[model samples]
Target: MSRPPTVWLTRASMLLVLLAIMLVSGPARAHEFRPALLRLTELADASGQGGGRFDLRLVAPALSTAGAIGEGDLTPIVPAHCELGQLRLDCGSQGLIGELGVAGLDRHPVDVIVELRFVDGTQVTAVLGPDQPTMTLDGTSDGTSGGADNDGVFADYVALGIEHILLGPDHLLFVFGLVLLVRAAGRNTRTLLWTVTAFTLAHSITLAAATLELVHVPGPPVEAGIALSILLLARELACGQTDETARDSPLLSVNESTKVSASGREALARAENSWSWRYPWVVAFGFGLLHGFGFAGALSEVGLPQGQIPLALLGFNVGVELGQLGVVALLLVLLAGGRALAGAVGLSEKTARLATRAPIWAMGGLAFAWTLDRVLGFWG
Candidate 1:
């Protein structure tokens, strides 16, 4: 039995409505993995030796699934003269000037952004990652020393962008769906290029807008919408899949003697008529806009440099594109190798079709699970 066009349209409409509701409703919460923040403010002393007392506020990531944030998860490596207390760090007369490092990055990997304020109102900020756990804190009141400049900002934000995209399960799944859809639709490299470009452009617009405070939306709904987008793509892939040998299969009527059914023709027709199948770029661009908000939310947690906002934004966006391209290239190569190996093994047509369709099924299942989890997260 064939599903009517109206039925498909209705299902798509319902999905859109659900996404809209998610966008409009829900309280905001932390949706993405964000870098930890460590703030240091100098406390003045009567001795006036540049104030050895310092106040500390450390916001670290939760180490356990139970949402328990343990300060012990991150160890602070200070100067030999400085001693870290519960809420205050005493640097003696030296006044907190030395190489600063945070250990235990290996146990819970995340970038740690350090912001230090000197007694003279000079502020310095630096980002520490697992690769580079230490940074120099010169304690200069010049506001230039000990902080990241334009080059450092570019490098840090770019790396953050790449890490976010690669480690972001939801975003990766959506991109994976796009690649699979393009391949299954037999789209050429040009079409794939346009599709990816459209997605990148759309997301870049929203990421900048949201990060710059040009636009504001709740985080949870945006997350739910992203999950919904993946689910919708998965549904489309499952519905419009054709057999591996669909081109070679004979398209004969039921009255004629044919071993293969007309499923291939039906699937091709369905795919051709479907809006997402015909112009996947359009779908990607639409959902990509929603995804940009999610990206901005994560970046917001890291906090951009006031002096180099544009540069940081550009670097992060570029990093995301680089990561996305790498993933696409890797997936294409793996797919090609799998096809070649299957052909060499002389796998039957039915087995080949099953193997080809397995990913779509798996994607759908995972998308559905994510959708449900995100929707439920609205209230929590």
Candidate 2:
């Protein structure tokens, strides 16, 4: 069935606007995997004295398969036991490796997440990234106390949380989608403001809950959901036409032989304006809950400081919002500059109207493709 001309033009406009965003974001890097993870678990020693032997597992993939994250090779760390076909390098009963690095130890060191799980059900997770490639597990700490500074625990998690959101482009892209949903377009600052707030509040709720173990959702499922959320917003963009109510709204108007008459156009204008005001908040809050779980999932993979769970959780949420706000500010600046440049060029009103919507279309396309791939990846 042919879409109404209004719908088609609207989608076309959105696609062009987001085309730049997709290009800048590099469409090839959707849900890119993080550096290698080196997890160390301590089994319970007999007599309950603690200090059990550690088991280490490193999972890295060089390539992704459909929805699954591909692992990188570990031959550099242990050429004797590591094989090209192996997805995981296990230390077996040998305990923690004396030294660990990625394929190119000298040239390119990567992060190894060391998770020291104790018999007492506590965990101490620390990253051994390029700056700190090798780690020595001091079994003496008993895995129950603060290995890092107690007062700085919150600060550390906040930094990690910020790093996670910024580095996790998928989450940031979702925020980008939210901005498009209620950005400064046509002076929708109020709608954008409330919508962004709602997103913050909602995600904070879930991030706190999930991180605290008040609720639990697995990594893959949460990831799939985040992708779907973006997909839904994209579909919304495709179906939504420009706000004819706004004089400068890039969406086509009724007089241009749209699918509607003048009256219908007015009706659409009101609906669209209202939709912009309302939909972003509703969508942000709803999808934000899922996104929070997604945050917890990422934090889990990297591991959290057991002694400072509350601080870590809170810090991570704050970090994510800071990253989100930073991106939003950048987007607003770019948007203003783009508008200025567009006006300076004296682009036709028609061109400007449609041009603004291009980004929405691009965002939708990326989200849809990601949703499809991630959903299919559950089989892995």
Instruction: Name the top lDDT candidate.
Output: 1
- The digit string of per-residue lDDT tens for model 2 on 180-288 reads 6565234366677677778878988997788678898777777777877877776655444543423333232223433444653665555466654357688789888
lDDT assessment of candidate 2: 0.59
TM-score of each: 0.79, 0.68
Per-residue lDDT of candidate 1, residues 251-329 (tens digit) = 1112223354477667767877888888999999999999999988887765776556898889888888888888888
For candidate 1, the lDDT comes to: 0.73
Best by TM-score: 1
TM-score of 1: 0.79
Clashes of 2: 19
Task: Output the worst ten-in-a-row residue range by lDDT, candidate 1.
Answer: 247-256
Which sections of candidate 2 miss by over 4 Å?
1-53, 59-110, 117-125, 135-147, 184-194, 212-224, 238-264, 267-276, 378-380
